[model samples]
Target: MQVDPGDPVEVNIWEAYIRTAVTHAEQDVSLVELERAAFYERCRNAYAVVATGESALYANLIIRKGVVAAG
Candidate 1:
């Protein structure tokens, strides 16, 4: 997913926010090689965090992923 915040400052802030959030969320999990690979494999299930407070008009993207049945 691409995040274009137009201004460089906004882009930096957005990146920082994402990094911080991910860091906190993974604080309890052991990110080993195999676990990291499995996480990447499930990247399709990830959702975008829209910073609508920064810009409303351009942040109207809706990402819909279809559900798949388990074998």
Candidate 2:
């Protein structure tokens, strides 16, 4: 089987992201998404699984009914 240059990094990044995302979820916040560009722009620009994946994606934090009452 062939290997991808970004494979190893992607795997590692994914693991970290999963952990972080879980932490974020526990925070009493709503709407969970991945902030690709910002994530990649962080650190020494080492890993960017989401940003450089099939398509760069970002997070949209919606605090649910707390952010705004049901209209």
Report the number of the highest-lDDT candidate. 1
lDDT of 2 at 60: 20
Cα lDDT tens digits, model 1, 1-71, are: 23333544322344444465568663432222223345445554656544456553222233334455599
Off by over 4 Å in 2: 1-10, 26-71
Candidate 2 per-residue lDDT, tens place, 1-71, comes to 11233545222344455566668664553324334444334433433233333331222222223344478
Number of clashing pairs per prediction, in order:
0, 0
Q: Which candidate is the best by TM-score?
A: 2
TM for every model, in the order presented, reads 0.23, 0.25
Worst 10 residues of 2 by lDDT: 56-65
Q: Each prediction's Cα RMSD?
A: 10.8, 11.7
